[model samples]
Target: MSTTTTAPATGTAGLPLADRTSGLVGSVIDSSTSLLAKQTHDIVRFAMGSPAADAIPTAALAEVARTALGVDRADAFDYAATEGDLPLREALVDMLADTTDATALDRVTITSGGMQGLDLACKLFVDPGDVVAVESPTYTNGSATALSYQADLLEIPVDEHGMDVEDLRGQAERTGKTPTVIYTVPTFQNPSGASLSLDRRHRLLALAREWGAVVIDDDPYGMLRFAGDPVPSLHELAAGDPLVFSVRTFSKIIAPGLRVGWVDTDPSLQPLLISAKQAMDTCTNLPAQRLVEGFLRGGYLAEHLARTRTAYRERKEAMQEALTEHFGGMARWTDPDGGFFLWITFDSPENNTEIDAAIDTEALFEVALAHGVAYIPGNAFSPSRRFPDALRVCFATTPPARIHEGVARLRRAVDELAGAAV
Candidate 1:
C-alpha cells in the first residue's frame, strides 16, 4: 500500500509534491457548488444537500452577526482556543443536555464543520493501509477523507435499515482483515436517507467491539426528524465508550455558511483533538463561533428546527409524489423520515441491464442540467462507481411546486437521453 510519487518528466518548475497529495481526492459534492454557480440557466438545483433557501434564518442570522460580531465585541474576531470558543461550547452543552447526543464539556470539541470532524478522526486513527469500512454509496467527502489518509476502504452494502452489519462481518471474515474504523452516517444518511435499525445498531457496536475498531458516527441530520420514533445516537448507545466518535454539525440543522460543528468523544481524546486542531487550522473561525453562540443563546434553534422539520417533511413527500407520477415503475427511491436527500435507482420492467444501460446517471447529469434541473450522479457517491444507474436528489431545498417542475424536467431529460441512445 506504499504510494510513491515521481516528478513530471518535462515540467521545468521542478516542485516535488508529497506522495500524500496523490491521495487527496476532491469532493464532487463541494465541486458542484462552483459548477452550478457558473451556469446561467434557470436551473432547479438538487445537487447540494443544503437547506431550502427559505429555510435559512437569514434575517435572524444577520441580526446576530450585527450584535455578536460588533466592534464592541471585538474579541469575537480574535483567535479562539483550539478546543473552541467557551460561550459556544457552553451553549452547545446546554442545548444538548436533554438530547441523545448529550456530552460533557471535556468531550466536546467545536470544529470548522462535520467534515473537519471526519478529517480529525482519520488523522487520529487511520494509518497507511489500515482497513476502513464505509457504507456503499456513502458520503463522498467522508470516504475521500479516509482515502486521503491512505486507508484501504471496504465498501459495505446498505439496505433500507442502513449499513449491513451482518454483511460487514462476512466481508471481514472473507478478507481476513479487520477494519480499523467503521465510518457511518447512520441516521437519515446523506444520500440514502435511511436510518439504521435498532437491532443492526447493536450488532454494529458488537462488531466494532470485537474488531477493536473506532466507529466514526457522522450524524448531521439527526435533529431534523419530522417523522418516526427517535433512535438513540451511537454515542448515546455506546455510553462513553472510547471507541465511538460522534460528529455533529449545525450545517444541516442551521446554516451551512456558518460552518460550525462539534465532535463528542472520550474525554481523554480532547487533548489530542486540541493538539491535532492546533496543527491544522489553529482554531475554528472565531466570528462564526460567536454568531452561532448568539443564535444558540437567543434560543433560536428550537423554533428553527420545528419550522424546518415541517417544511422538509412536506418537501420529501412532494419529491416522492413527483417520482411516483413521473417514474412510477421506472425507478424506486428511499423514504426517509427526515433529511435532505432521497436516493433513487433507475429500473425497468423491460430488463435490468438494458434499462441501466439506457439511463446512465453520469451521462444524464448533463442532460438534466441542460433541461434546467440538476442532481448528483449516483456514481459520484461511490468510489468504485457502483451506482452509475442511480442518482441522489435533495428534497430539502426546493418547494413542492419547484420539486414537481424539476422532476418533470428530469423526466424529459431522461426520455431525451434514452431516445438519443436509440
Candidate 2:
C-alpha cells in the first residue's frame, strides 16, 4: 500500500496559535530601525531612543573588553547564574550606591535588556484578563510586553509632570476596576521625556498599596538627566516596598547593542525571577554582563554620562530651535529636561490660513521619510490611537546641524502633504 503524505500547514493559515499570541503586539519604535536601515538616502534618524554613535565610550569599552573578555577567559562565554553574574551584580550594587536607585545584591536579577526586564515583570505579575494601567502615549514596547501576557491595558494621561495620578485615580473610580499592575517610566520618560513629580510619586505608591497593585518602574533613562533637579525614583520612593519592581538598563547611557539590563525587585521575588528567567533565556548574555561589569568597575560611567548629558542637552536645544524656526506657526512641543524625545502636536495657528487646518502626522510620516527625515508617528505611541495630530522626535542621535536639516525636511513634508490635500 502506497501512502500519500500531506504537507504541514505553513504560517498562521492552518497552524494552531496560542490565545496569548494575539496579544503579542510588537513595537513600531523598534520596527522603525529596520525600516530606516532599508533606505539608501541620507536620513537623519529621530525615531529610535538610542545614544549617538559618538556618545558611546568606544575606546573605553574596547580597553575594558581586553581584560573582561580576554582570550584566556573562556568562562566568560559560559552560562551565567540565572539571577545574574556575581561580579556584575556586585559591580551594579557598587555603581548604584550613591544614586537614587540604590539596591542590594539579593534584590537584583540580570536581564537580556530593559525589554526582557519588562517581559519578566509582566510574566510574573500579569494574568489573563488582568488590568494593567500604563501611561497614555507610553513606551509602547513596555505596554506591548504587558499585552503579550494577556493583560487588558488602561491608558492613563501624562502631562509635563508625568502620569497624572489624579487622572489615574478618577479613571479607576469611573471604571470600578483597580489595576493589577501600574507601569511607568517615571524619569526622563520615552517620547514625552517627562518626569513624575514628587507628590505624584508618593500618591501613586499610596494608590498602588491601596489597590494591591504591582508598580513596574521601568526607568532606563533616569541616569541621563542633563537639566533640572533630580527627582526621586519610584524605586527610591518605594522605600523597600515589595510592590515596586524596578527595571533598569545600560542601553541608553551605554551602547544599546550590548543588550544588558537588570531588575531590582523584592528579595522574596528573586528566586521566582531566577526560575522564570531560566525557563526563558537560561541566563542573561554572559559576555555582555561581563562587559558591563568591566565598564562599571573601571569607574567610566560617571564621565561617560557627563559627556553624553552635555551633548544631549545641546541636541535638545538645537531641535527645539529648529522646530521654532520651521513649525512655530502651526505646532507646539514639550520641553523635557532630559531623555531622547520631545512630543510634537500640530494645530492651526490663529489668523494663519497658509497651512492646513489639521495635520495627520501618521499620513505625514512617509512624506517625511521621502524628504530625508524620519520620526515616530504619534499614534504609534498610544494603543488607543489618540494622537493623530502629533508625532515623536528623538533629539539625542543627531548633531545640531543635522537636526536643523531634519526639522527642515519635516517642515517640507508637512507642506507637501498640505499642498496635496489642497
Highest-lDDT candidate:
1
Query: Candidate 2, residues 1-422: lDDT per residue as tens digits?
Result: 00111223334777787777777767788888889999998898998888999998999999999998999999999988899899999999999998999899999998999999999999999999999999998998988888889888899999999999999999989998789999999988887888999999999999999999999999998888889999999999999999999999999989899999999999999888988998899999999999999999999999999999999999999999999999877888999988899999887545344585578888888888999999998888777888888889999999999999999999899899998888
Task: Report per-prediction Cα RMSD to one decimal.
Answer: 3.3, 5.6
Show pairs that collide, candidate 1. Answer: none
**Taking the tens digit of each residue's C-alpha lDDT, what string does model 1 give over 281-396?**
99999999998999999889899999999999999999999999998868889999888899999985365433343578888888899999989988777778788778999999
Provide the lDDT at 321 for model 1: 95
Q: Residue 93 error for model 1, in Å?
A: 0.6
Model 2 / residue 337 / CA error / Å? 1.0
lDDT (CA) per prediction: 0.90, 0.89
